[model samples]
Target: MANITLFAQAIGRLPKECIRKIIREEKTDKHSKGYDTWSQFISMMFCQFSGCDSVRDISNGLNSANGNLNHLGICRAPSKSTVAYQNAKRDSGVFRRIFYALLAHFGQQAVWQRTRYRFKMPIKLLDSSTITLTMSLYEWAHYTTRKGGGEDAYIA
Candidate 1:
């Protein structure tokens, strides 16, 4: 029997060929040397699995798991700034396409085979409501008893 890290086992379910195809199609790694698309994907996956709240936490977590970097297909842990930059600059469409691709792939499994419906298209519900903040707790909102003043105040 061979020993496999839980992370490896989990991500191994994804089809490598499909992922590579998406990578080539998106050209996300173009002109990048070290921290390419694969690195960014792996880093984000780590953050998601480890429940990291921020880039610094992801960097520190990866740093601590230095010995497992090879297993994750990354040469080294990315810096907090690098993670932040990639997150802010990278095109979100690449990830979105990858997600739908994987979803379609897995939906073919036996588990989902029986759940097919007569609908021709899938319906996805989205919640676009802004986060609610209490004026009493967030005094920076400049809430006052005066009407028509504090209603438009938002944190972001």
Candidate 2:
């Protein structure tokens, strides 16, 4: 159907680079360099929201686009274990920056037409509600080495 094709086209379109430019990454201190370079991080995340559940899935099956992403200068499509290792060791705040970029992109996509009908109250999630389980919470829960590990009350 035409509608299906339009939706598919939207999915196939690359996210605007403006979204990447908007997120403000914190300046790293001289002593510490971040792992999983920015481009690698972005590629992994792009694959993530596109519904790739695992790093192996990133370049495998329907959502696979490792080659495509590589062509754009993002880091190499990593092995599953590599993705897991980097994710566990990296600063989570860095990942949050990607999320912020996504929110900005979504905001830009919202159209406010003059002839639109009155907007109704939007829905919201409760503070304690379970959100998406996209995190590697095992690290947070075990706290094998990080301070305050095993804190069940922590937010994802």
Candidate 3:
């Protein structure tokens, strides 16, 4: 049996061909030194999913994933310096273009599917409310244990 991590499965579902096409057009991997655009993307995705707060955290996390790196399409986990360098030097537009490409790819499926209900024009609903603040911020406002503050209101 082949051992695969859930992360690999998730990454596999992404439109890699679309991303590669964009990377080719954008020349995102021109200055890379072994660390390709695909690796950079996987690292960022791991950072987000793992809630890593620093480059060191991402490097350590990937390294700890052990043999699973190959399943994620990375030969090896990147070092802290390499990840940081690529992050700082790589064009963010490549990722942005990839996002739009994936969005368009998946969004078209939703657009073609018919819903049970239809509207003549598009509709938008907005829910806005005021948030209450502590009494220190609103001294002039009326304050009661039951109702809370009156004058201090934050619109959300």
Candidate 4:
């Protein structure tokens, strides 16, 4: 049996027919180009699953998996520039529709449905970047020992 990576197995289960239907309806690939909407979707999904920090990481990560990309349905991995351009130019609504379509296909409710309570104050997010910098170059940086808050509770 051929070995399939967990990422491939996970993405393989997505409703490709539903995705294609939405893509056709949206006309996301109206322009003639090698880098199409499907490729862009796969690239973005890879970025999310792999915790990629940037387009370069996504491109390099996919390129490194050259032999295995066929399982993801693309003929080849996209370049950094292609991925970046698609990310900037593509209509975001297409992706949003795809997300909703998949959620419905899997019989799952919208993400917002899981939140049972609303906070009086707006939520703020902090990014603790995965990238490391030299302490000498970034003297203002400080590390926090706080643990991530548990679910169903708010942290002040």
Candidate 5:
């Protein structure tokens, strides 16, 4: 039997070749001395998985899992300053592209075939609600008033 962390099992399903191709095309690692694009991507994924609130949290979390870094394909945990510098300087488009690529890949999985609906298209459900705010309390809010009353508004 092989010992496999959940993180490794999940990430193992991704097409590494495709991700590497995107990384090469995007040149995300260009001019990076130590913390390269791959390290940045892994660190970001770690932050997402661990629900880290800040760079220091991410650093601490990774440091605690130092022994498992090899399984994550990273040589070592990144420092807070390194993570912050890469985040500030690296092009966000690379990550965006990778996200879309992964979405497309996972969207075609066999698990989605068992949908209850006959329609094969993906369905997204959206709901809306409204909250009244006092003009004195929320002076910054500039909601338009209809002749009747407040119907609904999407803040986000």
Candidate 6:
């Protein structure tokens, strides 16, 4: 299989204290009797904060790697099925709460820090300067050709 343990380890090097605090303050009790809350959910977010884009990718990445997540107290790196089950079983309110909290915190920070310059809305300039006639002519010439009794031309 492709080796990713070293890469995972590198990501794991993020300060332990920082990870613990985020999990502690932002997370809920794991060993509760009634429901599953932050414990299971945090791993997925941790994967994202470490730059995993999707649960499927995180599942694949963690399923292969070792030492990194375990060090963060993810004793068992869950499979996709297990994660799906956990997600299905849990109270979705927890996810909503986390999402809103994240958005609010970032929003407040943006306002207070006045890094509006950095957070400014992106501007896109799509000018005719970059447009070329070559592509237009090529498409019109190549695509307009009648094929399959002109049905293909109509589809194009």
Q: Global lDDT for candidate 3?
A: 0.84
Give a tens-digit lDDT track for model 2, residues 1-156. 433333235444446454344323443222323333454455465565567777667545322554454444444555666556666765677557756766666666675423557658765543453333323654444333433333223333
Q: Count the backbone clashes (under 3 Å) in each candidate.
A: 0, 0, 0, 0, 0, 0
Q: Residue 143 deviation, candidate 2, in Å? A: 49
Cα RMSD, each candidate: 10.6, 14.7, 7.5, 11.5, 8.4, 9.8
- Model 4's number of clashes is 0
| Ranking, lDDT, top scorer first | 3, 4, 5, 1, 6, 2
Question: What lDDT does the true structure give each of the candidates?
Answer: 0.80, 0.50, 0.84, 0.82, 0.81, 0.54
List ranges where model 1 is wrong by over 4 Å: 1-3, 110-156
Clashes of 5: 0
Worst lDDT 10-window in candidate 6: 147-156
Q: lDDT: which is higher, 5 or 6?
A: 5
lDDT per residue (tens digit) for residues 1-156 in model 4? 988877898788898999999999999999938788888998988898899999999999999999888878888989888998889889999999999888787666445456578899898765443444455555544343332222233343
lDDT of 1 by residue, 55-91 (tens): 9999999899898788767899899999999889888
Model 2 C-alpha lDDT versus the unseen true structure: 0.50
User: For model 5, how does the per-residue alpha-carbon lDDT over 1-156 read when each residue is reduced to its tens digit?
Assistant: 988877778778877788888999999877988778878888888788878899999999889989988776778899999999999999999989999998888887856776565768766665576566666666554476422223464433
| Candidate 3, 48-102: lDDT as tens digits | 8889999999999999996788877789999999999998888899999988998
Q: List the candidates' TM-scores in order.
A: 0.67, 0.42, 0.67, 0.68, 0.67, 0.47
Candidate with better lDDT, 1 vs 3: 3
